[model samples]
Target chain A: MDMIWQGIHDAFSLTIQRDPAIVKAAILTLQVSLSAVLLATAIGLPLGAIVGNKNFWGRNIIVIFFRTGMGIPTVFVGLICFAMFSRQGPLGQFQLLYSPQAIAIGEFLLALPIIFSMTQGAVSSLDRRVADTAQALGAGPIRKLVTLISEARIGVVLGIFTALARCLTELGIAVMVGGNIANRTRTLATATALETSRGEFARGIAMGIILLSMSLSFTLFLAILTRKKNSEVTR
Target chain B: MIDINQLHVSKAGKSICHVHRFHLDVGHRCWISGPNGSGKSTLLRVLANLEQPTSGSCRITAPAIDIVYLEQSPFLFKGGLRHNLSFGLKCRKVSRDVRLKRVEETIESFRLQSFLNQDLRTISGGECQRIALARALILEPQLLLLDEPFAELDLEYVELVNEIMSCRPTMTVLMTSPHRPPESWSFDHLTMAKHTP
Candidate 1:
């Protein structure tokens, strides 16, 4: 208990000092998470929409795999990503390993399932009547999809937020694939890990504080967006 | 201008719609009414070609390809009412000016001025249905199939809808309902007798 308290105390002091190292790490973390989220959205959104509404050979199987991927261990994903981006790997020509891009790539994989599966769930759970209604209105595939997705806006946001949270945390992939390179790949998660392993309790505690704050702020923003008028909570 | 033949549909090996033969003509105002779970909607679904029959064929005389189905529930897209109305126009490559004109007409017809900016889910069921009707009308469909559209409407609104339906141009309309047509309203009606199987 004292160790934890002392670590927190020291962490806050260092963080408050505006340590350039800590600031750089925080920026890197945000960059990686944001990039991962954008990439995952680019890949996952359309895939989820198409997969949710259409049926084809192995469609069920593909969905099952995506859902299963949602619960995948971060380290497992990290290892896979590392192998793919490693010097001897197929994508090694890009030499992305140990770079911030590598961390983004790893985080992208971690966030992909979160975004894709939730999006799929949202699109599937959309009111069947919406599609029927759109079709009856002579809306085509693109228009119908746009309408359906909009109706399921809350669900879509939840999916994106879920992916963002996952990307923002999760140290395993960043450490393994990104090598936690200082001022490059060192995210809050990586910093937390590094501080703890080095017996730097205060720094670890500070990272924890920052992570908690980030998470809370993000969730609060989302909650505010979701609240509608005449909602009981407002009353 | 719609022809359906030997339409047989079953789900989980249980029959749904099994019409030996039926043909509907152009400009025909047909009413399909039946008890709950009697597949009235299913029969309409088959006619609309939205759902495939287990084993049957449906041929059209002049191809009601430009037909529209007015759903009981309105489906809203991401933006405002204008966005939802203009969506079909965008798909069909209609110009912006034409789309705006159509959307404005629908807004007035549905009396949706007050609710135009609100989300679809936030509106009343009656309003949603009206929005659905507006969306279908803007398509200029030659054929309209409605599924229990007035189920959620008030008596006054129902009368109002009848007045509006009367103004529809030379178009084939097939509306299904559980209640008898309002006495003040007149139409060419048909009945799908209760299942004997």
Candidate 2:
């Protein structure tokens, strides 16, 4: 217990000192996680918006499928991505497995449902006339979509931060898909795992500190972003 | 002219509108009047093409396919008021300069210039209704559909609605009310019936 506290103090001092390796790892983690969250949001927000806003046959079925996917194990995603990106697989030509890109893809799949369902809730819960107003304005399809997205921006930002946190914290998919390659795909979560296994308590503690710091930053931003928006929405 | 034959609308196996036949010629200002549960709003929704008539067809000979729908509850976009007003312009492929001009005119018309830069979502209900009016007028829609447009307005503002409706010659107005028509306005009142399930 004493050693853990000492290691935590050292981690903070090292982080404040701008230690090159820790900073680099932090940047890499952000790069991979942000990319994944953005990609997922891009794909999921519109998919969820369309599904939730426009009614067509079988929409409920698709919603059920997505809702069911929300709780899938990260290791299962890693395994599926590995199969799809391996040399013997159909997408072998891409050679993405065991790379940062593969990890990003895995994270994207993991976060997709989070962003999608939130976007679905945002769109469907809104007054139906909002869409009608846009349509009656002769707003084209794209214009109407932009209007809807703008209206749901608060929910989207929340969904994005949620995706980012999930991506950064997930170790199973990153480890399997990225191989936790040093100086390549090593993120804070993966580095923590590797460092702890090698009995390097100090290094693992530093990485854990970075992970917690990232989460804190995310939550702070979410609070600032949603404070005013949420107050008005509630009113 | 707006024409409908065999128009039908239903929800949860309950029919809302079953207007067997109706037609509104040009220069006709029609007021949809009915008792509660008589499908006045549903009839307007079908006419506006916002919702499909479950089992019928409708056509319009109006000018340029332009329409404005004033929803009972104002729906404010999340951005500044200008974004809400100009959203439809982008869809019409109207140039930015033209859009800005119309926005300015509409803002002045509805006395919303004071709130132009305010975030739309934060405004009061009456203010939101004014924003909706700005959005509707900015597009120069030829047909105007109002679903209880005066619900959130101050009593003083209600009298001015007719004047606002008459400003543009090409604009045709349709308002649905559960009470008698406004004085000084001639309207063909219609009642909607639902088929018993």
Candidate 3:
């Protein structure tokens, strides 16, 4: 209890004082996680919409594959990225390992399936009449898809938030692929792990506090956005 | 113009609805009348190309973009009356000025001007029917398929809809109803009975 209180006090002080180490780690965390989430959303939303809205051979299999991927361990993602970015590997020529880019790549792998599966669920749960209505209104295939997605926008945004949360707090990928280099590749998650392992509880708690704050901020933003949309719909 | 030759629709190997030798000229209005479970809605859906016939053909002379279908309970997309009314025109990528002009005209014609700023969910069923009709008509579709357009409407609303529809002399309309339309409608009738086998 005493240690926790001390840590909380230290955290506020560090935050107010604008400690360079904590600030750098936080910025890097945001950079890597946001980039990963953006990439995941870009690829996942359309793919999920296609999978959810259309009937084709092996669609069920593809959905199950992505659903399974949502549960893949982050450490395993880190390992796979490590191999691809290591010397003598197929993609090793770019020399991306132990860098922020490598961490983002690992986080991207971690986030993609989550966004894809959630988006698929969202799109699939929509009323069947939505497509028919769009079609009846003379919308082409692409336009019809846009209409369906817009109707399901709330769910899509939720999927994006979930992916961002996952990417933001994950430690295995950040530690392994990012190498947690001070001021360069370190993220909140990696920094927290390092500080705690080194018996620096206050520092670890500070990083944890920042991480929690970020997640809370994102969730609040999502709530406000959805609330405004719902009010518009009902008002 | 529309033509159907021996149209049959089924579900789970059970015959639902079948029509033989039906034809309607461009700019004509037809009412499909039947009892409940007689597949009046299914036939309209088949004509709308929303459902495939089990073993027949429906040929519409209008281009796909010029054909529109409304279900029994018309769906209003999330938004106010104006958004729902102008959705079709937006889909067609009409200019904002043109869209606004057409939407305003539709609102006036449907007497939906008062409801334009209200939440769509608060509107009555008859009002929803009008909005759905207005949305479809804004596109000026050559072929309009309406499944029970008057199902939820009151007598006054029915007359209002009839009056509005009467103005579109060049648009083809095919609507389904559980009973014969009002004597004032002047629609050619096609009666459907439930398939026994």
Candidate 4:
């Protein structure tokens, strides 16, 4: 209990004093996670819309592939990225190994399947009349897409929130691909793991507290959003 | 401005609707009456290009004619009444000022001003129908297909809709209903044959 209280005290103090190492890790965590999520949303939204709504020759296959990808191990993704970005690998000339970009690439891959699958599910569950009405209203492809997205906004938001959560808490990808470089590639998850391994229990606990707080904030926001959505539907 | 010949719509190899011959002149109104399993809605949907015939073809003479269809239980996207009214216009790329002007006029005509700012999902079915009709009308569609649009409305709203339809001389309307439309409303009647098991 004393150690836990001491850890909580140190967390606030570190946060207030802006400890450079802790602050850098925290900032990098935000940077990598946000970038991954933004890219995932940008790519996943349209792709999900198309896959979810259209019936094409290979649509089922695509859906199956993405659904399978949802469960892909992050370490494998990290391994593949590391293999490609390593000094002697095919993409080695770019020298992306052990860098923030490499970490972002891994996170992006991790978040993409989640965003796509959830968005696809959301878009797929919409009433068929929504698209039919849009078509009858003379909506072009882009307009129809926008209308569909708006109608399924709750689902899309939930998808994004889930992706954000996945990216924020990811440890394997951050450690393996980011290499947990101090003040450069270290994320909160990776920092926590590193500190705990070095027997620095207080610092590790503090990092855990920060991560838990961030996730809790997101969970609360999602709960409110879901309540609003339910009320809208019921009304 | 539509033609259907030997039109047969089927689901899973089971024929749901069959129309031997049908034609509509420009500005004409078509009221289709049938029993529950007679495919009145399906026929209207096919006309509106919402469904495709299994083996036959339907051709619209005026391909450039803007078309809109309102289902019995109309779908209103997540937004205020005003937003739903302006959706079709926005899709057509109408200017914002023109959209607002047209929306205001529609609200006044439909007497929907009270619910203009309210969420559409919160409104009654009759109000939703009125909003759907108004939304479709604002597009100035040349062909308007309605599927049992008056099934849930009160007599007053039905009369208001009829009046609105009567005023649009250039628009061709197609509607389906279980009962015959009011005598005051002129329409070329088509009866769908009930599907055999």
Candidate 5:
């Protein structure tokens, strides 16, 4: 109990003093996670809309693939990314290993399936009349898709939030691909792990606090948005 | 104008509705009447091109943009009354001024001005149905398909719809209802018999 109190005290002090290492790690975490989430949303939203709205051949297979991907272990993704970015691997010519870009790439892969599956579920669950209504209103294919996406905007936003939460806190991909090089590639998650393993409880707790605060802010905002939406629906 | 020749719609090898040799010329109003599950709505869907007949053809001789279909329970887009009323015009890429002008005219025509600021969720069923009809009419569609447009309206709205529809003398309309329409409607009736075996 004494140690935990001391650690909490020191963590707050470190955060207040703006420790450069902690700041750097937090910034890198934000940069990498945000980049990963943006890329995932860009690709996932359209693919999800297509898969959810259309009934072409192999759509079920593709949906199944994405659903399976959502459950894939982050460590497994890290291992595959590590192999691919290693010097002797297929994509090694770019020499991206152990860099922030590598971390972003790994996180992007980790976040894609989550966003895709959630968006697909959101869009597929919409009333069947939405598509028919759009069609009946003379919307072309592109316009119809835009309409569907607009109607399912709440679900799409939730998917993005979920992806960002996952990417921000995931440790395996960040530690493995980012290599936790101080000031260069270290992120909050990796830095927390490293500090805790080195018996620096205060530093670990500080990074953990920052990560928790960020996630909590998002969750709070999501709660407010959903509450407002529900009220509007019931009004 | 619309034409249907031996149209058949089925689900899971069970025949639901069939229409044999039906034709409506331009500027004509037709009301389809039948018992429940008689495919009145299905036939309207075929005319709207929202569904494909299991076998046979349904041909509408109008620009696709000039066709509109309203479901039985009209779907109001998630927004204020004005947004739902102007949705179709926006789809056609009408200029903002023209769109606003048409929307205002529709609101006035449908007496929906009172509900302009109201949220779609808070509106009554009759108001929703009228707004949906106004939304469809704002496009000035050459061919309009309405599925049970009068299902949830009181006498006032029923007369309002009848009056508004009576004014569009040149527009082609195909509507479905389980019961006969008002005596003042002047619509040619097409009764769909229930499918057997």
Candidate 6:
């Protein structure tokens, strides 16, 4: 217990001092996660809307695939990206392996299913009158889609929030594809792992604290938003 | 003005409704009443273009006539009561001043001023229904299609709605009901088992 307190104390001190290495890793973590989450959202939201709003051939099969993808292991995704981007692999001429782009790609893959599945669930559960009302009010197709999406805005935001959480916290993809290089690809997750392995407890704990606090803040925000939404819906 | 010719609708290969011939002049009111599952809503849906006819066609004489359909259970989207009230007007791109003025008038007329800023989900079922009607009326629809608009409403509201319908002399109204409306309002009767003009 004394050791834990000491570590926590030292962690805050290092974090407040803005230690160069820790800052670098923290920035890289945000950059990579933001990039990946943005890409995932850009791809996931439209696909979700399509699946949620329309009936087409093999839609159930596609939904099944996405639902299954949501449970896919991060390390598996990292492994797949590594294999695709490795020097000996086909289409490896771009040599993206072990780069920030590679890390972002892996993270994007990990977050996509989460965003897609949640968005699909949200849009699918919208009230039937969302479409009917929009149509009766003289809304064109694009306007109707906008209205429907706006009505389901809470669920969509939750989906994006879940994707951000997944991208920011997952270590398997970041470490495996980012290569954990000293200054270049060292995200917070990778840095924490390396520092802990080297017995640099203070630095590791500091990074962990940051990650934990960010995650907690996000969950609290979601809780508040969800509560407000429920009250509004139930009222 | 509207015209129908041998319109038919089906669900899962089962015939739902078949309307042989029907016509309505501008400013006319038609009341459709029938037993449950008699496709009264189906015929209204066909006229509202909410449902596709399995065969035949419905023709609107006015090329640019606006239409609004109100469902049995009033639907208020997730928003403030004012937002729900102004939704149809917003869709028509009504100006901000007009929207505000119209919303204000509607609130006063329907005695919904207290619910102006309240969340729609917080309102009673009857209140929501009134809001739905107010929203539709704000658009000044040339054609109004209502599905059992009086199901859960109070007598005061029922009379209020009838008064509004009567006041709109040029707006054609087609409504579905389980029974004929009160004796005060006169409407052309179109029964579904056999659509008699």
Residue B71 in candidate 2 has what lDDT? 79
Give per-residue CA lDDT, model 2, range A86-145, as digits (tens): 899888899998788899899999999988888887888777776887777776666667
Residue-by-residue lDDT tens digits, candidate 1, B1-197: 77778877788877766767777778777778766666778877876767888898877654434777765555555456777677667766789898899889878876778766465557778777776666666776678888888888887767766777778656778889877786555556666654544
Interface RMS for model 1: 7.0
Off by over 4 Å in 1: A1-13, A55-57, A227-235, B34-38, B61-65, B72-104, B112-128, B178-186, B194-197
lDDT of 4 by residue, A6-56 (tens): 877887777677678777887898899989999999999989987888888
As a whole number from 0 to 100, the lDDT of residue B147 in candidate 6 is: 90
Residue A185 of model 6 has an lDDT of: 89
True contacts kept of 4: 0.46
The regions of model 2 sitting more than 4 angstroms off are A222-235, B63-65, B113-128, B151-155, B186-197
- lDDT per residue for candidate 3 within B35-150, as digits (tens), equals 78888888877777778899988898998878999988988998777788778888778899999888888888878877756788778887888888888877888898989888
Q: What is the full ranking by lDDT, best candidate first?
A: 5, 3, 4, 6, 2, 1
Report the number of the highest-DockQ candidate: 3
DockQ of all candidate complexes? 0.34, 0.42, 0.61, 0.47, 0.49, 0.43
What would the TM-score be for candidate 2 when compared with the true structure?
A: 0.87
Q: Which order, best to worst by TM-score?
A: 3, 5, 4, 6, 2, 1
Q: lDDT of candidate 3?
A: 0.87
- Estimate, for each residue in A1-235, the C-alpha lDDT of model 6 and write its tens digit: 9878888999999989999998888888888888998999888888887788888999999899988998888899988988888888774898888889999989899888888888888889998878887787777677777777778787888888878888887888877778899889898888898899999888899999988877888889888987786565433
Judge candidate 6 at residue A99 and give its lDDT. 87
Candidate number achieving the greatest TM-score relative to the actual structure? 3
Q: Ten-residue segment with the worst summed lDDT in candidate 1 chain B?
A: B71-80
Where does candidate 2 clash, by residue pair?
Answer: none
Instruction: Give the poorly placed runs of model 6, Cα more than 4 Å off.
Output: A87-95, A223-235, B62-65, B182-184, B194-197
DockQ of 2: 0.42
Clashing pairs for model 5 are none
Ranking by DockQ: 3, 5, 4, 6, 2, 1
Candidate 1 Cα deviation (angstroms), residue A219 = 2.3
Taking all chains together, each candidate's TM-score versus the true structure is 0.83, 0.87, 0.95, 0.92, 0.93, 0.91
